[model samples]
Target: MLPVDAMITNQEKLNSLATECAFHRFSIAEIQAATRNFHNDLVIGKGGFGKVYKGRINGTRDTTRRIVAIKRLDSFSMQGAAEFMTEIEMLTKVRHSNLVSLIGYYFDDNEMILVYEYITNGTIEHHLRKADAPLSWMHRLKISIGAAEGLNYLHTGVGNQQGVVHRDVKSSNILLDENWVAKIADFGLSKFIDQQTSGVSTRLKGTFGYLDPEYYMTGRLTRKSDVYSFGVVLFELLTGRRAVDTSFREEEWNLAKWAEKCVKERRLDQIIDSHIKAQISPKCLKEFVQIATRCLKSCRKKRPTMAGVVLALQQSMALQEQYDSSPQSASFTHIVQHLFSGSRLNSVVSTSASAPVTPIPHRFSSPPVTPSPHRFSMSPKLDKIDPVHLTLNLVARATQNFSPSLKLGEGGFGTVYKAELPEGQLFAVKRAKKEHFEALRSEFRSEVKLLAKIDHRNLMKLLGSIDNGNEHLIITEYVPNGTLRGHLDGAHGSVLDFCQRLEICIDIAHGLTYLHIYAEKKIIHGDIKSSNILLTERFRAKVSDFGFARLGDAETDGAQVVNKVRGTLGYLDPEYMRTHQLTPKIDVYSFGVLLIEILTGRRPIQSKRSPDEKVTLRWAFGKYIEGDIMDLVDPQMKESLDIEIIEKIFELAFQCAAPTRADRPDMKVVGEQLWAIRMDYIRNGRRG
Candidate 1:
C-alpha cells in the first residue's frame, strides 16, 4: 500500500482562508443582467451541479462588452453550498494561466453562481467526442499538457501554496481557449492538502474507468488518483475512444486496460484514430504510450508524480523533435532512450497478446498526408457594428496632414499613418488615390456590411471608413505589434519562439475559418500573406486588410469566383492565376506561402544571391520531395524547433499549395491542420 498523508480538517484554516481572500460578490440583478436572466439560449455547458451560461458584461475600456461564462449551481443538487464555497475559497487562493480564473461569484438568497473568464473553444470532451471537428493528435496532447500543468500547480503548491487536489481530473474538466490553449476548470470537488505531504486519505469518489484501484478498493485517496485519471485521458487521446465505452468490445470496454495490453503488444498503430494516424511519430507515440502506462499502474507507488509526468510528456515531444531533425541516417528507433522515470510498459501488462503486432519502425515510414478532417465551423460569430465614422478634419489633426513622422508603413494600397483623435485615442489611417479610392467608395457600404458581418477575435476589428468625394480614408484599430512580415525580417529571424509562431499560424487559420464558413457571407480574402496578418499586444494573430475580399453566394460564385487576377507575385495560386477564376483555394494557396515564410523566415521573392540567382521554388520543392525538409527550415530557428511538427506543417503547406484546388484542403481543414501543428508543443508545455 502507498503511504498516505493524514487529511487535515481544521475549521479555523477554512475560516482564515475565507477571511484572507477578496472575492467579487455579485448581486442577483448583476447575475441576471450578465446572463440575460439565466436564458436557456446562452447555455454553453451542463454539469451535474447546474448549467453554465455565456454572457457579455460591461467592463471594456469604453463600456464595450466583455464576455464571461457563468456557472449556476442547482439549489437541490448534492453538490450544494459546501462545494460552492469550497470552489470559491480554493480559486481565490491560487492562480495560474493554465488554471481557470474565477473572476467573481454570487451568493444571495440561496442562489449561487460562479463566473469565470470565458474559454472560447469549450471543454476537451466537446472537441474529443461531440464536436464534428476532431482534434488532431497534437491538440489532444496540448490539452493533456495544459491539464497536467494545472494539476502540478495544485500538487506542488504553486502561488498561494494551497496544495489542493482537483478530486475530479477528467477531460470534461479541461477547457480550451481560442488559441487551443488548455485550462483546468471545475474545482467543486477539490480538496486541500498539506504543503509538504504526498496526498491525503479521503472518500472514494471519481468518474468510472479513471478511478485509482487502491482509492476505490481501500479508500486511500492520494494525488496518484489524479495521475490514474490523467492516464485514462491519455488513453482516450491515443485511441480516440472514451474512458468507458459500452460500445467497445468487452476486453476493450475500459480504455486504460485495453491500452495497457496494446502498448505491450506494440499494436499501437492498429488502435490509433484513423483521422490522426499519419500525424503521430512512431517514436513519439511509443514514448507517450509508455508514459500513460506508468500513470495507470495499479500500484499507486508505481505512478509518477504530476511533475514527473509533465517532464515525461515534454521528453516525449522532444523525442519526436529529435527524430524529425535527424533524417540523413534514417535510423530513428535506436536513438530514443528509455528516459522517463519508472519504465512502466513491461510491468503493467500481465501477459502479451498471443499475436504480437509488428514493431512500427519510425514516423518517416508513415504516409505523408493526414486524412481529410471534419469541418470546425461550430465557432460562434463575434459581434460588430457599422464603422465609427470620423471627420476629415479629425484625421488631418491626428496625422499632421500625412507627416512622415507619424507614418506607419507604405504598401500597394496606399500609405498608412498613425493618428490620434481628440480624445487622445490612437488609430491607423490609410490614404489612397481618387480612382482606387472611388472603387473603394462604391463598394464601401456593401463591403463594410460584409466586413461588419464578420466578427472573430482572430480577425482585425474595423473601426470605420471615410470617403468625402475628394479623398478616401479608412481607419482601423492600431495593432500595437507590427505585421508578421516585420517580425520575421532580419538576419537572425528568430525573434518569435516556436510556440509563438505556432499560435500565430493557428490564429491566422482561425481567422480564415471564420471568414469562409462561419461569417454570414462566404467571403474570400483575396490576399493572404504575412504583411496583411497583424499582431496584437498579446502577440495574437489577427487577419487584417479585407480591401481585396471577394463576396460570394450560390447564384454568383457557383461555389467559385471569377475576376481579373490580383495578388502578390509569389503567394498567388497557380490555378487561380492561370485560370482567372477565383476560389477559396486562392487563400489556401497563399496561406501555404505564408507557412513557408514562417518555417524558413524567407520572403516570397528572393531576387538576389550576390546578384546571381538565389533559392528557387523548384529547388525547394525538390528538397521536400527528396525527404530533406529540414533544408528548407530557417537554420537559426532549427535549434528550438519541433522537427515532427515542422514536418507536418511542411506537409500541410505542400497540400495547400497543390496544383489542383481539390488537392488543397478548404480553409476549415486548413485551420484544423494548423491548430494541430501548433498544439504539438502546447501539450508538452514547451514552444521553443
Candidate 2:
C-alpha cells in the first residue's frame, strides 16, 4: 500500500525531501484532467493500496503525451501512506533494469497520485494464470531469471552500500512489459539496511503462503526472506499454481509446503504442471529444484544469497538450453504426445485480460472412501522369516567383521552394515559394541519380540540375531536405497518421488495401524521419525527400529505407565511429554509429526527456527489459522497435487498432533484415512 509522496502532512518537509530525492513534480489539476477527474472507467487496477487509473499526461517539452499509471491511496490505509513515502524515497535513489520506473508525483489538499510509466503487458501473474495463453517454459525461465537479477540488484546494487530487501515478492508484483521483460514493483514492505550492520528486528508482515518461517517467527527480515519469496515465485512458474490458492485445501493453500514434500519425496513429476513439465529436462529440473530448495531453507544462513541464487538459476537456464537442442532429447512427436489432452487441442486460449483464462484441469477429485475401523489385517506369516540366532562368526563372515566399506549408516542405537550371507543373499546387520550391551540388549529385546510377532508388507522383517557376548548384531533383509532420512538428508543424491512418498506414507500407516491393533498385543511406537522409517530400492516405506516401542492396552487408558518420557522433541506428543502417560495416543501424536515432516520436508526439530517456533506443527497450525497452509508445502510439488486431498492429509496430521491426546484419532482410523488419501490421489492420476 503506497500513497503519492506529495501528499505528506508537512508540505515543507515533503518539498525538501523531493528536492533532495531528484524526482519530477506534477500539478494536481494536470493529474486530475489526465485521469478525467478520476473516472471509474479510467481505473485499470484495484488492490490494497487503492485504485489505479490509466492516464495520458503531456510531456515536459514535446507535444506528445505520455501514457502512465496513476495510483491514488485509500484514506483509511495508514500502511499505504508508509509505502508511498518509502517508495518515493527508494525509487529515487536506486535504479535497475528489472524494477518499475517512476515518472512523477501529484498531491494537494484532497488529492494524491503517483504516476508511473504504463506497463502494457500487465503482471507476470496475469500472463501466468490469468492470461488466455499459458507462458511457455522459456518464458517462465526468462521472467524468473529477470526477477532474480532485479532482486539481486536491490539487495546489493543500491548505492551507498545499502541492502534493500523486498519483503513482498510474488507473481503479481512482477510486472511484464510488451516485450515480456520483468519489472519488480511494490516497495511498500521493502527495507533498507547498511551493508556493515546486521539486520534489524521488526514486526512480521508478508502475504500468506509467501512469508518466510524464520522471519515470521523472529521478526528478522533479512535478505534470505526475499530469497525465500523468490523461491516461491520460482515454484509458481514451475507448478503453474498460485502462491496462495484458496480453491485448494488448507494444507495446499500454501504451495511451498506441498512442493517441498514433492522435492524431498522425489515426486517432482507428479506435482509439476503438465504444460511445462515436458519443457524442462530432468537435469535442469534437478538443478532448479536444488536452487529453489536452498533458497527456502528455514535457516537464513543456509539460504543462498540473491547473487548466488541468480548464478544458480543462470546455470539451470543453461542446462535447459542444452536440453532444447540436444540430439539425445526426445523427438517432437514424443513430447507432443503429452502436450495436449484428447479434446483440449480444439480449445483456443483467449488473450483478452477482461475475460477469464480457461483453466486447464490439473488434477481431478475422486469420491472419497472411508473404511470401517473394525477391519484389521493380521501378520501375514511369521514362518517366512522366524527369529533365528546365528553365531557371531557367521555374522562377521557375511559383513567381513564390520567393514567400513560395507557400512550403510549409523544411528543412535547401532551401525548398519551391508552383508552378503553364505546363501549369497543381501542383508542389513545392525550392530553395537560390547561396552553398550545393556542398552543395545534392551533395544534388541524389544525389536525381536515385536517384529517376531508381526508380519506385514509395510513392516520391517527381522531375519536373525547374533549375540556371543562380544559384538551383538541383528540381521534383516538388506534395502539398497537406505532410510527415508537418508533421502531427506540428501545423502542418497536423489529424493523419493511424490507417488512414492505418498505410497510410503500409506505403507507406514498400515504398519503402525497393524502394531496398534492387529498384533498379538497392541503396541505403541514411542519414536516415529524419518530415520526410523526404512526404504526399499523401490522407495517402499517399512517401519523399523522399535527400540522405544511398548505394549499398550487400548482397553484401559492408564494401563500403561512410564517413569520417564522417551521420544524425539519436535515429534514428541505435548500431552505425553507432560503427563508421562504411555498410551496409543502417544504413538498417534508421534506419527502426526512424522506426517508433517513428510509433507513439509523439514526436520522435526528445526534448530534454526525461533525459540517458540521449535515445532513444525506449531508453525503449520498458525498458517492453518491464517488460511494459507500451502506455504509450508514444498516448492517442487507444484501443479500435480490434488488440492482437496492435500488438505485432508494436513487436517489429519494436525488432528494427530493435537495438543489434546483424546482428540487424536486411533491408528486404525489413521490408516484408513491415509488409504483414503492415496486412493483419492490415485483416482486423480497421481501414479500417472
Candidate 3:
C-alpha cells in the first residue's frame, strides 16, 4: 500500500539510528587485525580497568605506519557506557604540552578500545623505583618544575572552558615525553569547576600519601589540595625514600614524619639519596627540603601558592649564578695588597681634581673600562704635574690630619677608619697604602662604580668616595651591630630566635633575587657566606663586599672560571675547587653551609669528635639519617625548640648542601620554603 519513494526514506532513517545506538559498530575483524590478532607480545601494561597494548596502525591504501597505545577496556567493567561518554567528552576538550593526548576510541558490544599517544619514557613512578636507573638532581629539579607548571596550568590556565582539578596528582599519573619533559596523564578522575564556584565538594579520593589531609577530613577540594600532594612528590625527590615504607615501625613509617624528625635533629644528610650526595650544592638541597616540608604540612591553608612555588625555583637558580661568578678570596687579597702598596696620599690628593671619573657599570653586568694613562697626558694643562706631590697631600687629609684615633681596622690593603662628617653622619673610610697606587686606583674605581649602582636594604650602602690627591678613600655605611660572624661569636643571650633567624634568611634571599633577576642586568654575589652577610640592630641580614665580584659573560669572563680558589674555606664549593669552574651553585653551597650552622648551632667544621664520628655538619647529617638525630641537635637549644620546625629547617639545610650544583635549588625557592615553614609554625603554635 506504501509508495516506493516513502519506503526508501523510512529505511534510510532506520539505518542512521542504528549507527548511533549500536555498541559494536566497529567490526571485530578490523580491531583484531589492527592489534595483530590480539597477540600476547603486543601487551605493554595492565591495570584494573583494562590492558594497554602497543600497536602499529596501517593506512587503508599505502600501509603507512603510526604507533599508538591501545587500551582495551574489560567487557565486564562497572564503568559502562556512561563513564565512557564522560571520559570521551572531557579528554576531547582538553589539550596542553604537559598532558597526554587521546587519539581515537572504539566501542564494540563486548569490549571498548582507547588509543593514546605513545609516551616513550613511561611513568614517573618507574624512574623512582628503578635500582639500576640513575636520576640526577638536576633532572629531578627539572621534573619537579615541569610537573608543577603542568598542574598549575590545569588548575588556573586560561581557555575556552573552566579550569580542571586533577584530583589524582601523583607520581604515577605523571608521564615523561621522549625528551624527559613531564606530561600529566589520566584525567578520568579529574573534575571541572565552573568559574563561579570557589571549590568543589566530593567523596574523598586520591592515593594514600598524596591525599590532602584537609580534603580527607572535609571532602572539600581546592588548588591547595594539589599543593599538598606535590609536597609528597617533593619528599620522594629529596630523600629517595618511598612515601609509605612499611619496613620501618609505625612511628617511623610515614616519610613526611620521618623527614620532619630528621630535619629537626639537623640530620637531613642521613635521608638524602647517596648517589647524588656529592653532586648537589648545599644551598639547593636545603631549599628543596624546606619546600617539601611546606608541601607536607598537616594544614593545607599554610601551603604556598603555586605562583609562589615557581618564583621560589627561579630564586634558587639565581643563587647558583652568584656562586659561579665570584672570584677567589686570594685574588681579592692580592688586589687589596696592591692597592695599599702602590698609591701614596700626596699623589692621590694632587690627582683628585684632575682624575677622570667614569661611572662604573651596574652589578651583574660588565664594568666599563677606564681611559688609558696616555689620554690624560694628551691634555696640555695636566701634562706637566708631578705625581709624587699629589699623593702626599691626599694621604695627609685622609688621616684626619694624621690623628691616630681615626684608625678603624687594619687589613691587607691598609687601615680603615671611622670618619665623622660635618653633618655628624658616621662613615668607614679605607685608606690605600702608597706602594700599591695602580691597584688602589683600580680597586677604588671598581668599588665606587659597583657600589654606587647597587641599592639593597640588606647590602651596605656606599655613601661616597673621597679622592683628596694624596690618598684614595672609599666610604661606606657603618653598621653599629657589626659583622654576622662577630655577633654569632660574642652575643651573650640567645643570639637569634627561630623567627629572627628565619627573617635573616628571607632578607638575604630577597636581596640576592634582586641582584640576580630584578636588577637591570643579572648580578651574582660571588662570595655569599655568613661572614659577608652583616646584621643590623634588628638582626636583619645585609650582604656586603663586591671586591671579588665579576660580571658574567662567556666571552668577556672567559668561560666561568676562577683563577684561584676563592671564598671561605669551610663554605667553598667542592666542584669549583676541583674544576676551577665557578657557577651560581657555589653561592648555594656556601649558603647551605651557613644554613646548617644556623639550624644545628654548629660550625661548618669541627675538630672535637669521636674516632668513628664525622666532625663536619655534612657527616653529622648523614648520621642523623641513620636514626641518630638526637646526637646532632645542639645540646643548649634542643629542649626549647619545636621538634617539627627544627626538623624542617634541618631538611632545608641538607638540600642546600647537596654536592651537585644542579641539585641545589635557587635562593628564591629557599626563601619561600623558609617562609612557609615559619607560617606553619605560627599557625600551629610551634609543635614540640
Choose the strongest candidate by lDDT: 2
Candidate 3, poorest ten consecutive residues by summed lDDT: 371-380
- TM-score-wise, the better of 2 and 3 is 3
Q: Which residue ranges in model 1 land beyond 4 Å of their true spot? A: 1-22, 60-64, 159-162, 322-688
Could you tell me the lDDT of residue 224 within candidate 2? Answer: 80
Which residues of candidate 3, in runs, are more than 4 Å off? Answer: 1-41, 56-66, 75-117, 121-416, 431-445, 467-470, 491-494, 554-559, 608-617, 627-640, 685-688
Q: Tens digit of lDDT per residue, candidate 2, span 1-688?
A: 2245544453555577678865668898788889998999998787777898999998755668999988887663556556777777777767888999888786555555688889888887777787788898878877888899899789867867588988999988899888888999888778898654547798887788889999899888888889899989999989989988889878787889888988898898877878887788886777678778777888776676675566556546655765787443222122222222233322112121112233321111232222221111222343232233244545566777577778776655666789886667676888764555685577667776776677777877777665544445667667777778667656778765667777888888888888888888888878887877888777888888776788886678424767766765456665564457788888788888788778777776564677445556656644443335467776645556654466667777866765556546788888886886777677656668
How would you order the candidates by lDDT, starting with the best? Answer: 2, 1, 3
Residue-level lDDT of model 3, residues 1-688, one tens digit each, is 2344543553354345335533122345656776897787998776645677888765333467667777777644444443454455556666677778766666544556666778888777778776378677667777787887787667656354376777777777787878888888766667777533447898887778678888999999877788888877777877677778898788768877788888889998888878778767676666667666767777764565554454344334434333344332222122223333544322111111112233221111123222211101111231232222223233334446445566544433455566554445454656566566565565456656667677778776765554544446566665656555554554534466566667787787777766655655555566676656767767889887655555545453223865665555556665665567766666767777777666555656443554233235445554434324455665545346655466656656656765456556777777776776777677676633
A best-first ranking of the candidates according to their TM-score comes to 3, 2, 1
Error of 1 at 232 (Å): 0.5
lDDT of each candidate versus the true structure: 0.68, 0.71, 0.61
- Which consecutive 10 residues in model 1 have the weakest lDDT in total? 346-355
Candidate scoring better on lDDT of 1 and 3: 1
Candidate 1 vs candidate 2, lDDT winner: 2
lDDT of 3 at 158: 36
